[model samples]
Target: MANKSVFATMAGKLLPRTDTRNHEGAQAYSLSPRQALAQLAATGTFNATFYAGAREQLTEVLELAWQVEPEFLAKTAVFAFERGYMKDMPALLLAVLSCLHGDEFGRAFPRIVRNGRMLRNFVQVMRSGATGRKSLGTRPKRFVQAWLEQASDVEIMRAAVGNEPSLADVIKMVHPKPTSAARAALYGYLIGKPHDVLALPELVKAFEAFKRDPSLPVPAVPFQMLTALPLTREHWVAIAETAGWQMLRQNLNSFARNGVFEVEGFAERLARRLRNPDEIRRARVFPYQLMVAFTTADAAVPKVVKEALQDAMDVALANVPAIDGRIVVCPDVSGSMSSPVTGHRQSATSKVRCIDVAALVAAAFLRANRTARVLPFEQAVVEIDLNPRDAVMTNAARLAAIGGGGTNCSAPLERLAQEQAKVDLVVFVSDNQSWVDATAHAHQGTATMQAWNKVKLSNPQAKLVCIDIQPTTTTQAKGQADILNVGGFSDQVFEVIATMARAETGADHWVEQIEAITV
Candidate 1:
């Protein structure tokens, strides 16, 4: 007679965001995540065709998750399986089920056992769902049993894994970064990294840096940064001895269980003095502290390209004046950057649009007094600052010298993280064509969501801007530009980057950033 339903207790408990668009999502090939889920539920009621590509499915899944509940996920988990939503999920969900209840917990994560009790909550989500009128998949059942009985290292790896290392340790890995300075301070304890972000780039750099030079630069940046306010030395970042950012950090346990990565090293925290980040005050430091640092090293790229990069910087500086704004931009001759900058598909010949734009933006930041570091990635980063003069041949030589081949997607983003507090934002303009994921059987990387997820985890405080100018040229035009994969792919890129940027700064900052790029 009443609504004593399992859905009621945990309707919106796990994930809180909800996608409300219902009509437009169906009319178009794409649906906002929430509509997809709603459609999935509605689709299950009737017989319907859902997309099959893993990347597309993943986008739909994350968008749904961003807005739906575990109850909704559970329903889709059950219903979508029947509808051929994506044939590969049962195995993944089984691993999740096992990881939540498996004994592998104490062994792989000994320190976590004391507080990782959150792992148990996952089972309630699995068992309470409607597996009604259906037989449990065997591999999934067996996996769950194996997990409940004896969770082994091999068992965990079988679930999902890869080697991912990071360069720094202090930055938080949470998404939707809060704007409050007080929250930022309290977040140090709560906003700490999950086992994954540590395995990203910053951890690698920080460790290698320590090995080479044990002394960490005290203030992070080269010189100084203006104090926002209430960021006094006496302030403590650790608040709510229990109720802090760890509220979610504790959930990172789920990551080890379901995500495709590992944390197989001495688990440790980066020790540093933290102040109340929630507050900012004027005159936190002298006016001179705002100046940014810039430099480019490595002689592999064409020297003229470096010159051109500098010339662009000069032009950008001439346009704006900001004290601490700086950029260290390097043009690449290493191979990947020289492909072509034209925004067309068939024109695979050489061109100079991205390099030119990269140089212009890099120089503009530096001229504004912000530090900019630019390099092109192939086997590794070729840090040759493209030297630009008024001469066209010089520009062409630099552009022609630079080459674009191979894939180096993560390197630049990691580079930005290495700069730490020194950089306030990162604007990466590139063509979204990675040999690694773009050619995968089914755009599997997009489905995994790790690469996208990693960006949110590692650079918890920096603004990341991706302007896709994927160009094409047959021969007539030097290069043409088309912004593709703003969401990573066309749809996902728009959703993912915008979400991460807003999370890094505030919604307001994200607005200003878009205006800067478009205006």
Candidate 2:
């Protein structure tokens, strides 16, 4: 009851708009808008308490974010949109554009509007505002035009005459002048809708220009148009040669859905692309991409295809810095972590759970540092043998096997203390739902804090790093000079670790330093 009350109290604090100041119950300073958005996107579940605070001060946060760190805000919005967190999306988008002055919105708008999912949501959100007698501010107009220019015919047609007549009026309000071959192709499609005379000529010119310069970037409009047109095998081959691995990866699902290969020898070519070590090293693949691939790969994908993907991931993993300290990773495998990750769409029978993220983080540390040990815990601690060369998912499965009956967050530290182990860093990957038995130590402090104090006493130099994989409640380990609390699964998490390892002042100092670097 106390634990539940603690969570309720934390949520209660966030309900008030004026109480934005950082406090023990509400660590507002630590919860940046970007970080909060990341947590929401990853978990697919919004904490009403947390989000209520965000919604109340949404414009203020956007204003501050734009003034201090526009790039972070822009990037976070794109990521949040892609991750399907859309509750405050209409306001969030408007706020982002309002805060950015001059051509800032113009430059950032393209990236946000290019996604089909984003475009669909934009139309819906904008239509809802129109229906509710809310104003569609002038700032989103530029983005709407940009989206119209780049959108496929299917999307344009859907927006133009589909259910919402206001959307058609909005689309007709802004006319995009096509400057690029791709945009020209999209323009041609738009004009051709009503049998405009310039349509054929525009399409021909765009195709000819693209055929002459295969190296030029193909925007979505032209790509979709070309797919519909009768293009020769040679043209598709040229497009394939010019398209980068990132593009190929992005379109893989589309290809699977359409049962069409944009390029010949799709599987073999992608496999070869993944095998290139330099390409893998240079690719901007994030940890979440790997997670998605592991979970969503079709059963028909060949063994070699899966192996190639794994090889690419391995190359990326090589970049993780090897820290110079003995690190013990304690991943909480309690029943709480069995819940499905927030936004991941999986079947009812799927076994993939939130704890997989904890395992992956532990594996990442193990792979990065030879001195790292994995101590998975539920009600108690258990050691799992891990090798740097082991596949990450394999390590996750191994860790998940030692499932715990209850959450005892302090068990890892207690085990280390019992063994008199001198660890430099103790990383707890958990939901931070640490609760003592109702009958035991009800009036005392948390078992995690008490165990952490004992560990600190034994090894004064040891620091506790709590990685909140499923942060649903207030963390048991308070943010302090020696304690670092990070949420979500990102490569940035490792960057923080590397920075902490090198810093002489301790966790808080480097935490500030990292925040500066990000900002």
- TM of each candidate vs. truth: 0.28, 0.66
Against the hidden true structure, what lDDT does model 1 obtain?
A: 0.30
Candidate 2 stretches with Cα past 4 Å from truth are 1-134, 146-188, 191-197, 200-268, 277-283, 291-300, 342-352, 387-389, 401-404, 436-445, 470-473, 504-519
Give candidate 2's error at residue 292 in angstroms: 4.4
**Sliding window of 10 residues with minimal summed lDDT for model 2:** 11-20
Model 2 per-residue lDDT tens digits across residues 195-252: 3334434435455566567555443332544565545545555555555665554555
Best model number under lDDT: 2
Estimate every model's Cα lDDT from 0 to 1: 0.30, 0.56
lDDT for each residue of candidate 1 in 126-190, tens digit (9 for 90 to 100): 33342221222343334333332343322222222111111011111112243443323322322
**Cα lDDT of model 2 overall?**
0.56
Superposition error at 108 for model 2 (Å)? 6.5
